[model samples]
Target: MDVDPLLTQARQLWIELAGAPVAFPTRGVAVVASAESSTCPPGWVGIVALGDAAICTVPTDDLVGVVTRACHMLPVAALTDPERLAAVLPVTQVLGPATLAYCDDHSYRPQRRQPIEQLPVHHPDLVDFLASVPAEDAAECGLTDITSAAYVLRAGTAIVAAAGYRHWPRRVAHLSVLTAPSRRGRGLARAVAGAATADSLADGLVPQWRARPAASRRVARALGFRELGAQLSVRVGGSDQTRLGPGSNTTAP
Candidate 1:
């Protein structure tokens, strides 16, 4: 109910330990006991309480362990201990999917690399872009509109990199940026991310970042988004009884 207090507290902890950029909280989400608040940035979507006592509003898994240390919390029980669902929260009722992870935003620092000229959507180019990344990974990343996705090129032929963003309510926008393994270390990721950030800022939508691996947090830090903390999204049966935090008894052991 009172997520702000936890969000505020997480912000302070994230900055101190994670060296993350700055991050904000989103609205309309339940707040865990440790999180300061549920209010997030226009692009960010949810607020997750970290074990180390931070709240992640952005998309950085790097800090999950950090939070665990601080909060004396365990790794997401859902993934590791699926049967332990009842221990954390009730599984019978409508407890949202307990997909928990730590997150944070890096302050947006301008990328110092040379810019890549924008290229229009060419079906071949889009296919090429998709081909560069692992097929399954790409799908998992939610690459549906290859034509609408943004890309960077080199030598006028090679589809070096690409990224995409999707909009959500509460001013939240999702980010999915990818670079070819061969073309990495060339700032292509940053270029695509810059495009997404510019668009979000222009539209006044808060970008909710969810980096799959821990390394991607660097990209967010360079962009000026701060770290919010981790979150747990549990989707159980459609019932009001399944809620997170200390007061909410819906959670199982």
Candidate 2:
């Protein structure tokens, strides 16, 4: 009867693990990354509430511990552990003995993006366009069924920019394949973003862009994606860094 509690728990754990808002966090929050993104009946789901935090479970005692003790924290903190972070997949954790020092901060908030009227679909010259890109990039974009999802702008494709989503449900869509470095200063980001936002709106979902660079957020602004705040990824046995959770956004949802 009351699914709100389960939904809240799953969403919170998803935010903790994935570092972004999740639209439909599954009933098994402890294993959310591995769980199928399906909504479950409230009665079938178990809940574990601790202080201000709660996690959805599969009606098992061990699952309760994993959800309450292990899986509930800000993403930035959880990401520091290699084994734990690996479970989240696609998100890299900086290991020790690395050259780069990890840091956390929001560089800036992007300006609001203007809407786009028409996006020209690329024609049969498309083979050359597809050839320019790697297959992994295409797979990432096509994860959400947006057809013709390949081609980065810097490769000198006509579209100027390309973008696509990873379905974490409506509350969260990972925006990937933003643009190539050589394609900067064009309105490609706006065009691609406008199209993606329109798709999300059509699906009755809220779009949350993930892990965008500070410069990329400028493009996001033109495409109607305000910052959900900056997220941090720290390396193990690395130098000290301050971390914030969901507070560094220039624009709040």
Candidate 3:
């Protein structure tokens, strides 16, 4: 695979979404933040790391200083670890410590053995497919929310698997893939995801795979997506935007 462009593209994509790079006490870990951080998935803090470079977005500006301090003090491993993030903030909920991956023209292994149908992401067939999935699985996969056209594998009128991408900042195709619980273990996720990813690349979009579940990650790996780093979203306090981020709070992971 082409390493230089991949590295540069991945690094710049996160910078655009989160913020510009800033100095950190740690050598390997660089930090960045921007106004966009406020909208970052309703978490106390959202950190998108590539290799040793971590781009963090907190809900508020005041938290930047405290989060930065924690970045300097925490090891790279700790910074990327969702539970370990409690060392700095209140740490109410953790969304991920997910593996971040990207695909290159050379690396992507398109799965063409299975037939796939492309449709508007919100099409009824795709909607019903998502509806058939277990609630928890549907929520976790986030496929129903994709803005790109869907690539689907159907079982009669029902969709057994689906894949698409959310249009994220920096033209990133944040890939979403879901296989119905009853239809899994059939290589269905990869077959459809491969089509969606191929289409995204053809349109000159960068494909991103933020895989949380081991099964999802496995499918991404099988399609030749290269894992680069991790993403961890931390939220503290109750429903209120409390002081955990900016003020003093030291809870261990």
Name the best candidate (by lDDT).
Answer: 3
Flag clash pairs in model 3: 44-235
- Which sections of candidate 3 miss by over 4 Å? 1-3, 19-27, 31-35, 236-253
Stretch of 10 with least lDDT, candidate 1 = 244-253
Ranking by lDDT: 3, 1, 2
Which parts of model 2 have CA positions greater than 4 angstroms off?
1-67, 71-127, 134-136, 147-157, 164-177, 185-187, 199-205, 212-218, 227-253
Model 2 residue pairs with clashes: 113-221, 113-222
Instruction: Write down the RMSD of candidate 1 (Cα, Å).
Output: 12.1
Superposition error at 204 for model 2 (Å): 4.7
Tell me the tens digit of each residue's lDDT in model 2 across 172-217: 4444444433565666665555555556545644455543244555
Q: In lDDT terms, how accurate is model 1?
A: 0.44
Off by over 4 Å in 1: 1-47, 50-107, 117-122, 145-149, 233-253
Q: State the lDDT of candidate 3 residue by residue for 1-253, as single tens digits.
A: 4446665677777666554444322235554445444224543577766765666776556777877787777767577786567877677776667777899788899776777888997788777777876777776676766788888888887888888888776677888888888778889888988998899999888888877677888888998899987777677565234332211111000
Error of 2 at 13 (Å): 12
TM-score for candidate 1: 0.51
lDDT-better candidate, 2 vs 3 = 3
C-alpha lDDT of all candidate models, in order: 0.44, 0.36, 0.70
Clashes of each: 67, 2, 1
After TM-score superposition, the amount by which residue 119's alpha carbon in candidate 2 deviates from its true location, in angstroms, is 7.6
TM-score of 3: 0.82
